[model samples]
Target: MANKAVKVGLLGLGTVGGGVARLLMEKRAELSAYLGVDLQLARAVDLEPARAEELGLAPGVFSSDSWSILEDGDIDIVVETVGGLEPARAMVLTALNKGKGVVTANKALLASHGVEIFQTARQQGVGIAFEASVGGGIPLVRSLRDSLAANRVTSCLGILNGTCNFILSRMTAEGAPFDQVLAQAQEKGYAEADPTFDVEGTDTAHKLAIVASLVTGAQPRLDDIPTEGITKITPLDIQFAGEFGFKIKLLAVLNNQGGKVEARVHPALVPHDHLLASVEGPFNALHVNGDWVGQVLLYGQGAGRRPTASAVVGDVLELARDVAAGVPGRVPPLGTQASGGRRLDLAPLDDARCQYYCRFAALDQPGVLASVARELGSFNISIEKVTQKGRQEAGPVPIVMLTHEAREADLRGALKKIDALPEIVEPTVVIRMA
Candidate 1:
């Protein structure tokens, strides 16, 4: 008897879609042998069919309209790699309604509409696999959903966005400014022209929200999470951080305190010897700490055509195997029970407790440090170490302070009072030390 053929329909032919198509064809024999099922590409949909041709796809396999795939009877799996929220959202929902197992690499859509998407899949008794959404080919989602399923995830700290990481890495290494390195990242194709989403920490926050929802089973409100960008970081700050045994990296943080989850994104001063601190350039690393599993670190190329394609195709194979075994919805879309009804409180940023690296550009006159210290002491924000850089004579002197563990609220209050002082020349730079 001939092998059972699991037909797949691809809904996008962009970078990741092209890579998935190539991988499916190139690894057909290996995948078929491993899954004990033959995978076949029935149709590929893209606004530009020329991308399919550019990838050397067969003439009959590519189409300009997605309706053909959505309307097809033979497509058992629909892979959607379209990045945005629009047509991609409509296509994924429609495919699920049609009883087709869907695989997607749309993080933005999933972050914003995951509850709706998962609910639809559950109601329709179909499967949706999104391993490619969070960490590209790093397998972080599978680890959280399957491998670490037994443990109570305590916290997840990661460098989730490559563009920000690359820019920060360049700035730290060369002691260059943010604009220079950002321009370099854009020229090298690591950053987008606008780069606002990635640079402003929105991208990292989106990934953090997804990871938090999956691990805690409590879908969080994305807007409530406090977010900060890396644009304020300067080479002088980087130099000061190094002198204090810390490196600044854009971090996505999700921590479960008691039962409430804290989700935030910002530039943090990581100790130089920390594992996440070494993750440089346009790479991503996630450090997940669980009660039973202890610390687990996953690192890899976070994005790019083939890297992301590896994850997209992995989801396809899993879906194919599940369909062939007649267990289409064996695992839930989030690999857990539906959490749409669960309300996870996002801990306010002011409640956080951590050490801080505070830099103040103040007048060289005496009592400047005394005034700042007095205000900090008023809030019980005791300093662990304080250093004043050599005077430049013409400009405000730089005073860097590393504080012991202090409540974020106290630190902010003290900084606000100090900033109002006439002696303070520039806005203080307050970076949390992890």
Candidate 2:
């Protein structure tokens, strides 16, 4: 008997796809030795075959038609880096139905349709690997699913989006406004021309959903998670946070209390000495708290051709090893139970309890501070400390307060009444303290 070759096929020739192809070829001999099989790049599918030439791949190895890979019986694994929702989903599902393993970095597609996709893999008796879907090159997903498998994950907090982190870091460093920092991020290519997805917290929310599923066995509804962007963050808030020994970063947090889960994405005031606060620039860091393992922090480049591709290829090797072992679906898609029977209730953001940082632009009237305090008391929200400077400014004075731990609903109601006061000149800025 001879050792059969494990054939691989790629569905996209973009940055990540190119990197995967390059790494696969470069490390072919070592990977083959480790897996105990001849690993081959059977073929690659791309809309523009000319792009394949740039990667220095032979003509026969790259094809414009996707069917050549998806329908090929010899291709044991299908890697879908084409991204987007449509063709990626269709290709992955097709490959699984044909008894081929799948590896993907399409976070949007999985976050949206993961339940159905994972169930399909189970039905087909094949495994689906999505290591690159969250945290880029960092092995957060695998660690949570495998290494920390013994302990129960209590809470997950992360600066998941690098673009927003970079923008916020710049604002904190240079005392720049949101608009100015965003423009600088675009110039540096850290952010896209239209960075709404990354800046608005949608990208972080998607990654959180995937993380929540692995932490718990339930596939959460993406639309149900409360999300808030960093667009409203200003240098004033940054300065105030620094004064309070804190830094502001957009955070994707998931808490599993008993069986109830609370998932949200928003800008939070992290203590200056906290590990997450120290994670600056375009780098990402995820903090997971488990019963036995305690707190674990994984930090690295969150995205780019090389980092993302590294994760994608890591998944490929994992699935390849599974195929060789003859235990393809041994590990569940959600990393625990094959049947997602656990249905955890989603916690409403209004019910969450946390400290708050409040700022008000007031008319500097003697009773203005008293009025704000009284309004907050009306909602049963207590202030921990209040800072008001009596400078001889022409306009309204800035009144900043740090409130004790209070219900989110109560803070919202208090802010509504406070903003309605005649002395308040502009909208109140309220950031949650982590």
Candidate 3:
């Protein structure tokens, strides 16, 4: 089996698919040594005929329909990179039904329909490996689900989306606005042409959902996990957070508090020395808190053509090794679940108790401070520090306050009273001092 070549069928020969094909064509011997089996790209599928020919793929092997690739008699494994729910999901189901192993990078599909897909594969006794779906090519999914299987993951923190991380990191680094940095990321191919999914933080939410399911032994439904984006992070707020010894990073946080799992994605403040605070640029970092390992940080490039393709091929080799060595059930079903595990509720946007950093424009009245403090004190939220800055010509002087651990709802309630005060010229800008 060490010298045996395994045939592979690929769906979608786009950027990532091209890289997978390139590896099979050029790096077969290199991969063979690692997996103990030669890998062959037996067939490739694409929607465009000219595009397939443009890449100089074999004449007899190209198919516009991906199902034809899955049904290929000679192919043992199917690699899905077409993305989206429609044909990609249908194609993967067909391959699994046919007892052919599968590898995919579709986070949305996996997050939404993974329970059914994994159940089907588990019943059929075939593998569905998806290491590339989460952290680009970092292999965090396998690291948590396989390497750290012995330990219980107490919580998982991630800055998952490269685009969101890049934009936020840039806004903090260059002091450029989100829109400006986003335009630059789009130009650099770090952001998509549409960029909605990446910037809105739903992309991180989807990835986190998958991570939660893989780590918790339960399929995490997307609706159960809440997500927040970085669009509202202002440079002023960034500066304010910096004064308090923190760096803002878009974080996907999943925690097991008591027994309930809470998943969220948002801009969070981490102390400069925290491992995740240093994950700058377009790179991703996952800080997994295991009961035994305590904490492990996985960081690297989270997206790319070759990097993503490298993950897909790694899945191919993993499946090939299992088939060649008759290793049964060593690889768990992709995002598999246990019967007792349930989808945990998403922590409300304003439920958790976190230190608050808020700034407001207030009239420099002597009694104004007392009025503001009373409002927050009603909710049992106390101010730790208050700094009144120079007056502004347009309104009251700016008052910056750092609060002790306070509920988000309490802060929201107090802000309502403060906003209505004549002393307060404008609304408050608040962020969690994570």
**What TM-score would each prediction reach against the true structure?**
0.97, 0.97, 0.93
Over 256-345, each residue of candidate 2 has an lDDT whose tens digit, in order, gives: 767478899999999988889999999999998999899999999899899998999888888888888888877888877644534445
TM-score comparison, 1 vs 3, better candidate: 1
* Model 3 error, position 239 (Å): 0.9
Between the candidate structures 1 and 3, which one is better when assessed by lDDT?
Answer: 1
Clashing pairs in 3: none
Which residue pairs in candidate 1 have backbone atoms (N, alpha carbon, C) closer than 3 angstroms, thus clashing? none
Order of candidate numbers by TM-score, starting with the best: 1, 2, 3
lDDT of 1 by residue, 39-93 (tens): 8877898898678878787768898888889989899999998789998899999
41-106 per-residue lDDT for model 3 (tens digits): 778888777767776776577777777876676688899989999977899989988888898999
Give residue 206's lDDT in candidate 2 (0 to 100). 90
lDDT of each: 0.89, 0.89, 0.81
- Candidate 1 whole-model C-alpha lDDT, 0 to 1: 0.89
Compared with the true structure, model 1 gives a TM-score of 0.97
RMSD of each: 1.3, 1.5, 2.3
